[model samples]
Target: MRNEKMNTNPDAVRQPLLQVSNLAVDFGTVDGVVHAVEGVDLESAPGETVAIVGESGSGKSTTAMAVIGLLASGGRVAGGSITLDGRELVGISENEMRRIRGRDIGMVPQDPMSNLNPVAKIGTQVAETLLAHGLANRSTVQQKVIEALSAAGLPDPERRAKQYPHELSGGLRQRALIAIGLACRPRLLIADEPTSALDVTVQQTILDQLDEMTRELGTAVLLITHDLGLAAERAQRVAVMHRGRVVEQGPARQILEDPQHPYTQSLVQAAPSIAAARLQPEVFQTGREQDAAADAVADNIVEIEGLRKVYPMRGSASDFVAVDDVSLAIPRGKTVAIVGESGSGKTTTARMLLKLIEPTAGTIRFEGNDIAKLDRAQSREFRQRVQPVFQDPYSSLNPMFTIERLIAEPLEFYKRGSRAERRSRVRTLLDDVALPQSMLQRYPSELSGGQRQRVAIARALALSPDLIVCDEPVSALDVLVQDQILTLLGDLQKEYGLSYLFISHDLAVVRLISDYVCVMKDGALVEAASSEEIFTNPRDPYTRRLLASIPGNELGIAS
Candidate 1:
């Protein structure tokens, strides 16, 4: 019904705008030629959406990259047929592909922060696409840029065009990327996890705008994502990929209702859906009073009272208030999650708790000691006791270091044990985090995103910290990997009594992992309650909106 304006009639016979047949892609690694995608077949009609759904390393992105002729270095189409508008594209030259790129096939890559030019203004980037494609000249480029941004649902497009990517939030940056991708009004749009990093409300807004624009343009879409709920909601057809192959392909609703493949079934089960019950029901079954009584018996691991952070602008009279009078507590061995959109002060609050940034005002008490007033020795002890597992595992782990050394770095810094003992500890930590001991020799680049995140967790656990600040730890991960990581975190907490300061934009994830949830908006706490209370009976309007915006809420079908 959401796609009624577009051509989504399955019974109608029509030529596909884009097509691929028996596509195989290979990457020349140091070891050998690795087949990344094999015998894959896909197609998308004009004004239709086809989603490739899979876990990380399942070759969905590789397929998209191959389609766009932008495969990474040493990757090539080993054997495949790729046709766009009835034109073969497998053997096109770089020049020919460049001409086809913006004019016919536009891409909205994942991680807008990386895809966007950090130094270039938003308008300049949009103008480059239009100019390169001969869609706009210098005289009309500015107007075109503003129009593109406005079409992408960006507010105040004129001011936004003059600003750089860093000046925008994640959602805004994603909108800017959308603006750039659609500037030339391409026939086919390849969106690779475009909304994976965004909050639910923002994701809904972006997807709605994309649907509307693509419907109006009659553009075909190749959506590459790991989210089953997203695919079910957005795509007409879903192609399920696993280990370099399309294992199943069918209508989205049919795939969701009666998935034949075991992998597809697993994906549906693992995905955190709004309609599904919490993963850890026991954590909620214990009454809030009992948990509070336990916390009263044992001290809260960390406490914040009227915490605030202000960044002074060079010329602005009113300083930027990042975290305004935010106050919360993390009970010992319990997970207290902060859920908010980008720039909502959740991460800033976590950074302050980790002592990475000094708060402008208020108090942060860790284990009954004021962290701000700690002595040199006490500060060192606090640093050792509280560690962080940052977002973006791709950047968090040191590429040059082996997984062994990366985990051992904190142990070595703390002088926890002898060389042999630290190596053994690293192995143990890997085991604790569900990583193989054999991975100790591999570098970060050699591992998948989930494995890299596990390594980051191992490194964080190496310090034996009482509190771990997880800032969107699983945001970029697939549902299965995210479920694994969340389960691992819960198991580790139970085993080690580790407290967590979890910050994320995903309410489903927060519901699954958190004992308590703090909802933040515009640099302030709007609601704080038990996870059960927040999810079932949220009092705040923003919280209700976030819940409503979750992908599967409308479907109401159990995963």
Candidate 2:
């Protein structure tokens, strides 16, 4: 492994820490060849953070997997040269790559849930990297593992080290993965959406930790993420990829402040923070306007009174209260956003509202009726009024079914119309969501992330639902696509007078679409107020911390 240090002069150009020239990856399939990555070129300077920004299917992950020699079966690097410290890596043997992976270049994958070993203790998995590189002996490894865990900012590191991956929250699992990546103290680190699954507070902490570690260790970082605001705040340089190609690359400030590429400009404009800056003051009325509107009759659509959901652990003596006496209301044609960290009971509340799970106590009222006490037939009718749009579009939609069939199935199940009428309604709904009729025959695998999400929205709207529970619908999408989805949701609400129970961890998204905001922490509601009130004058300490944790919150506008 190369550990050459560059000159310290600001004017002096440093030698690249890692470089890839004309990289291409191919996978063989029954129908045809899948060109996952094509002629991609990227490089990182020593001690500099380089960000790769792109939408899904832009070959960002494929590039990272290729660099680390972790590509799936049937996937091969067909062409190009990958050089680390001037050494060739394209045709390196598996053993050689494995030796270099953790010792020289480490990686933090996108999804910690699947990346971690469910049955193994997190400490053991983190220590495995040190053992692989011969960095510590069995006697000393335990102490080193604890140190790594602490450095990654896991609370109660000693206790957490003994827990399995399933026992930890999503943010904690991600931190454990980072701990593993940093165990070997590699020269370069590849972090792929490290904070994608974390809440605002945890995300900020992770980013601050990563920045501090990289600066202290003088390690080069290659960050791959869909969050433009995060890239602008953390990275020195940015590379924008589109359709498996680098369409733009330059300094972060230059690209964000004065982007020359159309795609880059679109991404910057579509950023939630930037959009909020342009629209916040207008959408959030002043004190006078709010006072005037207060006298106007407010329309109420859905109400909950002390809703509680408790789950009993099989071996545990006590039950866990996922939703603890949560109470809130959703106004007609308004969006109510629920913000919280993982295991904060956001999803559990949504499940109770959907009636998918029976609440241990409390009342759920939909349009002045007690939904919790409803019979089976009434509950079925209530489901049609309230629909759900789940996260993970890839898994939410059935892969075997066509778009048309998937959309029509909901209408058929509700018995709202005949076959011909349902088919016509499906086409209309597709159009409403800005999807083309041509996509009706295609399967889920044939569509993009944004496209599939649009299909999911169309399916949800099949019954003309009064309220839609959007569970992080746009969190996984790119900036441009997320903007489109948000705008579409707003338009749908305006046109159809549809209400929304939006659940997400992205503060910027909440600021954009939410008329009211609810903050949750540790299975409890910290505060519930108007969006502007929550943003300007949060009564709860946790809510203030969340707002402060947003990237570039100190700045007046989005970076």
Q: Which prediction has the highest TM-score against the true structure?
A: 1
Kindly list the per-residue Cα lDDT of model 1 for residues 459-511, writing each as its tens digit.
Answer: 99998899999998998999889889998998898899999988888887887
What TM-score, computed on C-alpha atoms, does each candidate reach?
Answer: 0.95, 0.89
Give the clash total for candidate 2.
0
In candidate 2, stretches whose alpha carbon ends up further than 4 angstroms from where it belongs are 1-13, 26-39, 72-74, 274-298, 310-321, 553-559
Write down the lDDT that model 2 would get.
Answer: 0.83
What TM-score quantifies how close candidate 2 is to the native fold? 0.89
Q: Across residues 1-559, which tens digit of lDDT does each residue of candidate 2 receive?
A: 0011221234312677789899999989888899888888898876778889988888888888888888888899999988888899889898999899998998988778789999999999988889989999899998999999998889999988999998887779999999998899998899988888788778877777777777677677889998877877788788998888888998776777788989887777777872353232336654345446645854668888888888887676999888898888787878889999888999889988898888888888898889877889988889998999998888889999999999998888878888889989998998899999999999998999899999999999999889999999988787778888988998898899899999999888888888888899888888987788777778898998878777744322232
Q: Could you tell me which residue pairs clash in candidate 2?
A: none
Task: Determine the C-alpha RMSD for candidate 2 after optimal superposition of all C-alphas.
Answer: 3.9
